[model samples]
Target: MRFEVLILGSSSATPIYGRHPTAQLININEQLYLLDCGEGTQVQLIKYGIRSNRIKHIFISHLHGDHYLGLIGLISSMHLVGRKEELHIYGPPALQEIIDLHFLHSQTVLRYPLLFHPTQDQTGESILENEHILVSSFPLDHRIACTGFRFDEKKRMPTIDRTKTEAIGIPTAYLPLIKRGNDYTASDGTVYRWQELTLPPPIPRSYAYCSDTVMTERYLPFIQGVDLLYHEATFLHDMLNRAVETFHTTARQAGQIATKVQARKLLIGHYSARYKDLKPLLEESKSIFPNTDLALEGNWYNV
Candidate 1:
C-alpha cells in the first residue's frame, strides 16, 4: 500500500501569478482524499494528471473562500462529467448549507449522491474508518471553526512462514488461523505457536494535515509522531505580531509545532501573497526544524 500527498495549491487568501489557494490531494491505498478545495483546484488536478473521479472523499478545514471557493465548481464539473459514484464531504456545520444554496440557485441536480458529514465538536476523534485506514479530526485555534485531520493506516496481519508450515506437513486449511496468531494443534498433538511461525506485522504509517491555524500546542497529542505533517506557515518570523492578529502562524511557529510533535518531516505552506520569493520562509522554518520543506505546488510527498 502507498500513501502520498500532492500539493495542489499553496498561496494564501490572495492569489499569486502562478499559485492558487490552499488545496492538497492525499492518496492512501489507491483512494483519493482531497483536503481543502481552494480556487482552481480542479484545474490543478488536471494539470497534475489526477483523475477527478478518483476523489471519493473531500475534507474542508473551514468556510474561508480561499479554502473552499472551488467546491461548487468541482462538484458541477463532476456532474457534467457524469460521475455516478457517491461522494462524501466532511466539513464544518455551515458547509452543507453553502453547497445546498449553490445547487438550489443553479437548479443543478447532482448525478451522484453527495453525503455531508459535519464536524460539530473540538476534541480529536475518528471520523472515517475502513478496513485499511482510519481518519480522525481535531480542533484547531483559528479565526473560524477549523479542524485538522490525521490519517492512520491499520495494523497489518502477520505474514505466515511458508517454509515452517511445509516442513511440519500442515494442511493449507490451518494457514488462515495460523496467520491470525492462533496456534494450530496437529492430530498427533504437535503444537505450533503462532509467534514461532510468523513474522511481526509491519508498522502502520500516518500523516497529519493542519491548515490556517494559529500557534497552538493542544494538537500535539493527536498528530504526534506522524510520518509526514503538512501545516500552514502563512508568514515569516518578522510578521509574528501580524500572525497573532490574523490568527495565522509564522514559519517558525509551524516548525516549533512539528518539532513538538516529533514529526518525521514537515511541509509548510499557505504563504502570504506579499512574499514573491519563499526562500526566506523556508529558511526560517528550517532554522528551527531541519527537516522542514516548503509546500511547492505540484510536488508530491510520499508518507
Candidate 2:
C-alpha cells in the first residue's frame, strides 16, 4: 500500500500569478482524500490527471474562502459528470450552512448521496475509520475555528511463510489463523505456533495535514512521529511579527513545530502572495529542520 500527497495549490488568501489557493490530495492505497478545496482546485486536479471521482472523502480545515470556495463547483461538477457514489464531507459547522444555501438557491438536486460530518473546533477526536486506515482531527490555533487532520494506516497482518507451511504439511484452511498469529493444534496433539510460519508485519505509516495555523505547539502530541507532515508556512523569518499579527505561521516556526513533533519529513506551503520566490522560505525552514521541503504545486510527496 502506498500513501502520497499531491499539492494542488499553495498560495494563501490572495491569489498570485501562477499559484492558486490552498488544496492538497492525499492518496492512500487506491482511495483519494482531499485536504482543502481552494479556488481552481478542480482545474488543478484535472491538470494533474487525478480523477475527481476517486476522491470519496473531503476535509476542510476552516471556513475561509481561499480554503473552501471551490467546494461548490467541485460538487456541482461531480453531479454534472453523473457520479453515483456516496460522498462524505467533513468540515466545520459553518460548512453545512454554506453548502445548503448554495444548493437551495441553485435548485440542483444531487445525483448521489452526500453525508456531512460537522466538526467542532474545540474537540480532538477520531472522525473517520475504515478497515485499512483511520483519520482524526485536532484543534489548531487560527483566526477562525480550525482543525488539522492525521491519517494513520492500520497495522497489517503477519505474512505467512509458504515454504515453512508447505514443509510442515499444514492444511491451507488454517493459513488464515497462522497469518493472524494464532496457533493450530493437530488431532494428534501436535501444536503449530504462528511464529514459526509467519513473518512480522511492516510498520504502519501516517501523515498529518496542518493548514492555516499560528505558531502553536498544542498539536504536537497528535502529529508526533508522523511519516510526513504538511504544515502551513505563510511567511519567512523576517515577517514573524506579521505572522503573529495575522495568526499565521512563519517558515521557521513551521520547521520548529515539525522538529518538536519529530516528524520524518516536513512539507511547507500556503505561502503569502507577496513572495515572488519561495527559495528563501524553503531555505529558512530547512535551516531549522533539515528535512523540510517547499510544497510546490503539482508536486507529489510519497509517505
Candidate 3:
C-alpha cells in the first residue's frame, strides 16, 4: 500500500522564485487525493505527470485564494477532457457557492457529476471513510474559518500462519476464529494461541495537513501521533509578531507544534514569498524538531 504526498506548491501569498502556492497530491493505497488546489495547481499536476482523473476526492483547507484559486481551472479541464466519474469535493459551505458562481457565469456544466460536501469549522469530525482510510476535518486557528485534515489508515487484520496451521492439520473452518483472536483446539486436546498461529499486522499509518493555521493547541488532539505531518510555516521566528497578526505560524513554531503532537516526521511549507531561500526556515524548524523537512515543490514524502 503506497502512502505518500507529492508537494505541488508551497509558497504563501504569492509565487516567488521557483515556488508556487499550497497544493499537495496525496496517494494512499493507490488512490489519489488532491489537497488545496492553489493557483497553477493544474499546471503543476501536469508538470509532475500526475493523472488527475484518478483523483476522485479534493479537500480544500479554506477559501483563501492562495489555497483554492486553481479549482475552477482544474474542474474546467476535467470537463474539457470529458471526465465521467463523479468528483467529490470537501470544503467549507461557502466553497459550493463559489464553484457554482464560477460555472454559472461561464455557462459551463461539467460532464461529470460534482458532489460538494461541506466541512465543519467548529469541531473535528469524520468527513470521509473507506475500507482503507478515515479522513477527519478539524478547526484551525486562522483569521478566517479554516480547517485541517487528518488521514488515518484503518487497523489491519492479523494474517494466519499457514505453515503452522497446515502442520497441525487445523481445519480451514477454524481460520476465521483464529483471525478473531480465538485460541484453536486440536483433536488431541492441545491448544494453539491465536497469537502463536498468526502474524501481527503492520501498524496503521496517518498523515495530517495543516494549512494557513497559527501555532495553537486547539487542533493538537486531532493531529497527534501522525506518521507524517504537513504544517504551514509562513514565516521565520524573527517575524513572530507578523505571524501572529496574520494568523500564520512561523517555522520555529511549526516545529514546536509538531513535537507537541508527537509527529513522527514533519514537512513544513506555506512559506512566505519573502523567502527565496528556504534554508533558514528548515534550520529554524529542525532546531525544535530534528525530523523536520522542507516541503518543497515536486518533492514526495512517504508516510
Candidate 4:
C-alpha cells in the first residue's frame, strides 16, 4: 500500500548546485519502477539506500543524455550483482538498439533476461498492467521522440462487513459476489443487497511523470486528475524562448499545465544547471499553481 516516488536527481543537462541529473524511483505496492536513469543514478540509488535489485522496470522518456545516460551502467551492475529476475525496459524504439550496442561492445551478457517495450509516439497507450496497477505511456511534445508515463492504481473490491454477513448467515461462497457489488440470495430466497453487506471501495490513486517536454495541450487529457504530477521545469519564464527552442518547458508554463490538468500536487524539477538557486523558478510556478513543490533530489513524494 506504500505508493511514493523517490527523486534521485533533479538537475537538467548536467549535475550542478548539489543536484544530479534526472532519475526517479517510484514504489507502488512494494514493486519498484525506475524512471529515467540519468548519469550517476546508480550512485544516487546507493546514497538514497534504495536497493537497485528491486527495480524490475525502467521507463525512459527519451534518448537525451540527461534523461537516460546511466542506464547501461545500471543494467551492467544488476548483472554483476547476480540478479536473476527478468528486467523490463520501456522507451523510444531506438533505446533497445542503443542498449544492445553498449552490451555488445562491452561483451556483457546479462545474468537475467531483458525485455524491451517500445513506446508509441502517436498517443496514449497502456504499456504495462498488473493486478495492482496499470502503466500507460503517452506521447509528449519534444525535440526527440519523447513520452510520459501515467501510473494508476487498479480499482479495489468493496470492503465486506464481516459482522453483517455473519449476522445474516451469509455463506463464504457469496463473499466474492458481495465484493463485486452483486446481491446475494439466501437459501430461503431472501435477497441481501451488496450495499447492505459492504462498504464502498477506496478511490484509486494516480501519478503522472512528464519530463523533457514542451508545454503543449495534447498532454492535458492524459495527465488530468493525477494525484501527483512530476513535470520538468528546466528554465524560468525569463528564458521562455530558450526553453521553447530546446523543446523544454519553463517553470511558469509547467505550473500552468498542472493547473489545467487539475492535479492535486505538482512537482517541478529538471532544473537547468545555470540555476544555482531554484527559488525564483519555484516562485514563478507557485504563482500559477499553489500546490506545486520543487522536486528536490532524495525527496519522497507520496501519492
Candidate 5:
C-alpha cells in the first residue's frame, strides 16, 4: 500500500549537528500526510522533492516552537503558490489561534480553506479516517498539551481467486462481491462459498508518532505493537535528570518504552543540541531495543 515515513528534521529545541527541527512525512498509498511542522519543514519538503500542494493533512503534536514554528511559513508558501484545495490541520485547540494570529497580523488571507481539528489534551480520539488508513491522536506526557498520533492501515478485502471464479464462469460484476465475502450462486443453483474463492486478507500495518514526551506508561497502550514507532529521544540516559526535568525522553528510556510497548521497530530522534554525534544515542536505544534506528533526516523508513 506504499506506507512509509520520511524524516524531514530531527533536532530538538535547537537545530544542531546539521539537523533541522522535528518534522516528518507519512506517505500512505501515494497520499502524503505531514506530521509536526518544525522549523524549515517546507525547505526540507522542497529539498526532498515533495510537492507542498500534495500534502492535504498536517498533524502537530503540540504548540511548542520547535514543533510548529514552521507552520506559518509553510501555509504562506502554499498560499503564494496558489493552492486552492482545503488543508486540514490536527493539533491542540490553541494551534488554530496561533495560525490565525500570524495570518491576521500579516494582513494575508489564504486562498485555500483551512480546517482545524482539535485534539483533546485529556483523552485520545479518532481524528481522521479514509478508505486507506485510520488516524488517531492520543495524549502524551509532555510539558504542554501534547499528543501522539497513530496511523493504522485499514483492513483490506479478501483477494478474489480469478482461476476459481473464471472456471465457474462467474461474471466480472460479481468479483467485487466475492472480495467482500459474499457467496455466489451459479445460474444452475450451485452455491460457491466466498471463502473458498478468495484468499485471506493481508495483515494491516501501523505507525505511531510520539512527538515530545517524557518516559511514562500513560501512552504505552495507545501505541502498543506498532510496526514502526517514532519516539523523541532528546537526551542520553546520562542526562536522564534533565530529560525528566524538561518532560523529554532519553535514548535509553525511549528504548525501554519501545520494549514495553512491544513495538516491532523503533525510530528515535528529537535530538538535543548538546549532541554533535548521534551514534551514541542510536547505540543507547539499540542497547535495549535492538531493532531501534535513528530518525535520520531525508531517510525513508518503510512500514
Candidate 6:
C-alpha cells in the first residue's frame, strides 16, 4: 500500500519566508485526505499537481484562521468544478456553522452532499474506519478546542503461495480462504496447513498529524509508534515563553514529544513568521531528536 504526506503549506499564523499557511495532503492507498486547509491551499494544490477532486475527506484541527482560512475557497472551487461526490469534513462543531454562514452570505449552494463529523473535545475517539484504513482524533492543548488526527493502515491478509498451492493440488476456489489464514480440508480428509501455504503480511504503518498546540503529554499515547509524525513547531527554544503564551510549540519541544512517543520520524513545521532562516530551528531539534526533518512545502514524506 502506498502512503505519503504531501506538504502544501508550512507556516504559522502568518505566511513569511516564502512559506504559506498550514496544509497537507495525505495519500493512503491512492485515496487522498486533506489535513488542515490553510490560506492559499487551493493554489498549492494546483502547484503541486494534486487533483482537488480526489480529496473526499478534509480534517480541520482548530478554528484558527491560519489553519482553516482556505477551506471555504476550496469547497467553492470544488462546486464550481462540478464535483458530484459527497464531501466529508471532520472538525469542531462550530466548523459546520462557519461553512454554512459563508455559503448563506455568498448565495452559493454546493452541487454535492456535504457531511460534517465533529470531533469530541478532550476525547480520543475513532472517527472513521474502512477495510483499508482507520482514522481517529485526540484532543490537543491549544488556546481553543483542538484535536490531532492519527491515520493507521489496517492489518492485511497474508499472500498465498500460488506455486505451492498448485503443486499441492489445492483447488483455486480455496485460495481466498488460505490467504485469510484458514486451513483447508480436501474431500479425501487431508488437511492443508495455512502456515505452509502463505507468507506473513507486512507490518501496518501509521501517520499522525498534530496541529498548533502547546507542549503537553495528553496526546502522546494516541500518536505513539507511528511511522511518521507531523508536529507543529511554531517557534524556536529562545521563544519558549512566547510559545507557551500563544499555545504554540518550539522546535526543541516538538523533538521531545517525538522522542517520548517513540515515533520513527518527526516532520516539524508551522514556522513562525519571525524565522526567515529555519536552519537554527532544525539544528536545535536535531540536537534532541536526530531523526527530525523540516516540513518543506511540495515534499512528500513516505509513512
Query: Per-candidate TM vs. native?
Result: 0.96, 0.97, 0.95, 0.96, 0.98, 0.97
Q: What's the lDDT for all of these models?
A: 0.92, 0.92, 0.94, 0.93, 0.93, 0.93
Q: lDDT (0-100) at residue 29 of candidate 6?
A: 85
Off by over 4 Å in 1: none
Pairs in clash, predicted candidate 5: none
Q: Looking at model 4, report the run of 10 residues with the lowest lDDT sum.
A: 177-186
Task: Give one digit per residue, the lDDT tens place, for model 5 in 3-115.
Answer: 99999999999887789999999999999999999999999999999999999999999989999999999989999999999999998899888888888899998999999
The runs of at least 3 residues in candidate 6 whose Cα sits more than 4 Å from the true structure, single-residue gaps closed, are 186-188
lDDT of 3 by residue, 1-303 (tens): 789999999899898898898899999988999999999999999999997898999999999999999999999998898899999999999999999999999999899999999998899999999989999999999999999999999998899999999999999999999998999989899989999999998999999999988888799999999999999999999999999999999999999999998999999999898888999999999999999999988988999
Candidate 2 displacement at residue 13 in angstroms:
1.3
Q: Residue 113 CA error for candidate 5 (Å)?
A: 0.5
* Model 6: ten consecutive residues of lowest lDDT: 178-187
Residue-level lDDT for 98 in candidate 3: 95
Q: Which of the two, 2 or 4, has more lDDT?
A: 4
Report the Cα lDDT for candidate 5.
0.93
Number of the predicted model whose TM-score against the real structure is largest: 5
Q: What is the C-alpha RMSD of each candidate to the true structure, in Å?
A: 1.4, 1.3, 1.6, 1.4, 1.0, 1.2
| Local distance difference test, candidate 3 | 0.94
lDDT of model 3 at residue 111?
Answer: 94
Per-residue alpha-carbon lDDT of candidate 1 for residues 191-232, written as tens digits (9 for 90 to 100):
889888888888999999998888977777988999899999
- TM-score of structure candidate 5: 0.98
lDDT of 1 at 149: 91
Residue 147 accuracy (lDDT) in model 5: 95
